[model samples]
Target: MEPSEDTSAVSPVTPPPGCPLHSNAVPLYGEALAEDDTERWERLRKRFGGLAPVKVEPEVAAWLILGYEEHRQILRDPHLFTHDGRISRELLEGRLRPEHGTYPLVNYRPNALHNDGAEHQRLRTALVDSFEKLTSTRVRAAIEDLANDLIDAFAADGKADLIGQYATWIPLLTLNRMFGQEDRHGYFLCELMVKLWNGEGAEAGAADQAMVEYLTRLISDKRRRPGPDITSWLIAHPAELSDEEVTQQILLLIAAAHDPTTHLIGNTLRLLLTNMDLRFSLAASVIQIEEALDVTLWQDPPFKTLIGRYATRDTTVAGYQIRRGDMLIPGFAAGNNDPILRDADGNPPHAQRPVSRAHLSWGLGPHSCPARGIAYQIAATSIATVSARLPDIQLAVDPGELRRRPSPSINGLVELPVTFAPQQPLARPHRAEPAPPAPPAPPAPTETVERPRTIGGIWDRVSGAVRAWFGV
Candidate 1:
């Protein structure tokens, strides 16, 4: 490493006083790791400090990074702590495999999110350049329109499950628009995702293969005829990404970007319905949409833990023995709650929650999420549209009854049932005069690059849970 920092201080291999033995390591997915449960996290931290040994799956061990500085140190050094999962000892030893639930997450993939160094730059550049082509105004307009369309579907009903009816549909349709695919295509893909996430054994595997075919068709079309969509932009970018790279990035967008943003909306909505102060502030114009969303992210973000970060060499972090192939899972929830990063007095509810504060909800360092702006645009517009249309909406069930999804795939409430005075939907006037012609679509990709002789194809690792619990 460069100059060793205080955060990198290692203790004797004999082990720290309170460190739990490997056989007694805590469970990363257990109840204590719940997003809002600070007491449990505190207890775990008191015993294990920043680097807490935990079992990711049955018999699969890893360390959950709980200290903010320790987490930051690891993420900042990419060469030492890599995103690529191929070097994982568990996978190499056959303790983890593609068939396991955690495999799809930590398994090696040829995408920007899972690579490092110059290779990562090439793959990541393709995504950044493509995203840079989007116009904020255009994106916001699309999100607002899509939001209204989804709201209009259930506005006449006195009650609705916001999660199923609103949160899920917004991301699905918005992503479809971004991908330059038809609404029918997104709906079909969503059906397959649901099957893949919910189906088990051969059924889940079958659904996974179907998703592969669906995306393959999409990529093939873009290759033949370029368009304004992200898919087309990637093909035309200077990075010279292969067809497989383009597909993986798109899959990552759908899996990583879609679910968290969906859940952020759900989490914000839950606060609005349950927290009186937030609702009052939002209705009274005391806080903007961005502030409201920020509150949720700080307190109950879209995920409890970020993806796996593997060690490139054997090292010790806070007295935890980290082998060359050892994996460190960023504890998003725990890191956000790290007292060192927060006020000594402690965090308050959403009403008093600070805005624009640092948080690990989107991960950290060079590998942090690149789609924060787009994700916020879609989520903010979706929440605003519903609030405007149904100002009187209130939670139908007791706030205590809202349950967190126990699945490893999601991070927010199970459902958000709400009731409102039946309201008239927005009306559009029809006239004999036709509307002005629509603007032209993005020009076909003019940037030239050599195509790979062999365009690799693979299955998408997006589990069915995104479909079942489509929110964060």
Candidate 2:
């Protein structure tokens, strides 16, 4: 269906000044909506009802799906509410330009997150197959080991910014290991991920381009020397994906992995440290870290709102008219706390809620997160490891003083300042040096070699080549 040209379908009510949905207001993409999301969502719900039209960019307005059922309906039926939208088309047609101050969100590329039909299925299958290697047992062990290593770094410091030192590093390290990346490239990927998340237009685009180039090199190397890693697995998959396809898949995987996992770890930790009821439940063994993770997912998912699902045709959702080409966002956080799903006191009725994972935190439908189990394992294990080691860990500052990072795509803490009792670093095994090679068999009996050559010349050449190859 062609896009509707009718503007009257949108609410004619004039928004008051400073309202996010107001036509004259600045685009709401930063800390304002994310910092205090609960109150802000409530206000938006009250003002605009469920399907509210809000500005994602200065001149771009989209309907934010705030109702629980409405959100689910949109997700369930991709035919009516599809992921393919005008922004993506514009991006493909080279009509979308990136300014230094603009967010590079709608610069769509063909990946699982931005596609539909058979193409999405193909890309998603490759991604799912790659992640299948990360079994729950393996993920738990790796996360636990990485978490402890991070803790060991600051265990004796008595105070540490858990967000910076622990939550942030754990996922990055784990992903790097899974991708078979050295520490240098892993750190570089982390830097670029942050730049893409927080930087604007030119900077963000450059970071993304750099990531593609880096991943291309990484994929090329993996092709030459396949290893027991995700990248190698992708390269060897029966799909026979080209270099660009493999690079895009890996880029999407990395992008999806880092932000959500980091925030999941951070948000779950925040709950455990600050929510006394949750802490007591954990201490009494009434609830596991996984339950706390569920609560956090339900209450404060990492991404408050998702981007760019345009209506395939003119339709009405929850009493609001959705014209074709109108952008629709699934308010995952808001929908999770929709009034219809909550009790009279405005809280989730835990007892009456369905046993199924109904929360939109990991999203819904065919486009839902594929690596959610691994994500959960990473988060749960990280929290458990920290709790076991730092039994007395507490927030260093008042809860209200903490700030959320400014981004439309994420709801994460800027820093989680935490204090715990100082303790000795855990002991780790030392690497054993290789035994000297039997003096080269006494220079072979038949060879009457001259004794004038320098002793370390051959070793130097070998070490230099190794260092050069590995970029060490």
Candidate 3:
């Protein structure tokens, strides 16, 4: 461990003396819809004084790392900053006496978010294989078929909400296709995902529980009658895992795959529509799709906030004095936007000629996301297919009208409205010559005023209220 620096002599910006335990909760970037102004991220940089301290729970504190070089270093050095919340959980749950003692729901540990070393490697390896199976060629081809079918239905209408019709459809249907899992559970999982990532949960405790219940049932059915699906694979290899462990991993996998892809698709639509020049550029150069994806991820990653380790021993990060047990957050959001690290003019770092400014979308070092390649490939191919097939797509609704889930962790629109000219792939237009004819112009029609009906207002309200109350 590195020796601790003197906190006393370092640049001192005293925190409020005695605020509420969670007062300095440190609103993450993009938490507040208004403050998400990306323009201000540079201004906020000066306030860090090398380290920005934040409160997670009322008493649980963590440092938000923003400096590009230091953030890179912390992510690389796994020894000093530990991801295993088992240590922190013991403190919060009063499990210091026994590691497995029950406490608040927050005290419980999940699969491998907080693990390191060989255990971490094992968990990650399993997940990598799972993802490979998830995004295989056969699975992608199935997704392509689904996308084409959905497009065919909407082409006749000339207008449809992209999120409602396509973006949401692809991911949900892809998940269903890959796992052969059903959304017979309704949009419950999607809604839960939006809430969990957004960190807006009165039922955060019950969120994972709900997933656990669903996955448990899924794993059980698969075990009884296995197939060539992901859940079946998990059942086939239960040697290193118990039934419950298998269930938990599946739940985690489903959640990870669902939200990230949803946001990636959603964000891609928003970016493409807003930047028409970039959109046209991409449409023109099909081969440039990969670079476009790299740029999109660098500019705006789907998940902006992620949890990380607390220092196990005295350590220095970004030249700030960090004591043992101080929580550290590797801010993916902040890192991607760091002006000193990226070109403010908006040139994405090329993979072939990688510079110091590569986006930390998949993260860095040991715990980096293993499924990034799959995510990129899936997102890229989906967009490429659309661009090649329908180059004239545009927003159906006003750009400002689309709403993003007001969550800091996940950044994607709740609804995205889009429109495009309808055309059948197999049908071709025929040209014909027309003869001109002389005719008088018709007079314009007069506008008519409609009478208001007031008697039915109460009846309509009562009926609407009843339907809402009963959730009809």
Q: Give the candidate order by descending lDDT.
A: 1, 2, 3
Residues 42-141 of candidate 2 have per-residue lDDT tens digits of 8778877777776664444567888888878899787787776543322322322243122134434556776777877888888899899866776676
lDDT for each residue of candidate 3 in 147-243, tens digit (9 for 90 to 100): 6655665677777776666665566456655565643332455544433333323454355444444455555667677877766765565236556
What ranges in model 3 sit over 4 Å off?
1-25, 29-33, 56-60, 89-107, 133-135, 180-213, 342-357, 397-402, 423-472
Candidate 1 lDDT over 98-184, as tens digits, reads 445576667666788888898889998888888888899878877777676666667778899998777866786677778888655
What's the TM-score of every candidate structure?
Answer: 0.84, 0.80, 0.72
Pairs of residues at least 3 apart in sequence or in different chains that clash in candidate 3 = 83-114, 84-114
Higher-scoring candidate on TM-score, 2 or 3: 2
Q: What lDDT is reached at residue 436 by model 3?
A: 14
Candidate 3, residue 201: the lDDT equals 30
| Collision count of model 1 | 3
Q: Arrange candidates by TM-score, descending.
A: 1, 2, 3
Off by over 4 Å in 1: 1-21, 29-36, 200-206, 344-354, 429-472
Quantify all predictions' global Cα lDDT against the true fold: 0.72, 0.68, 0.56
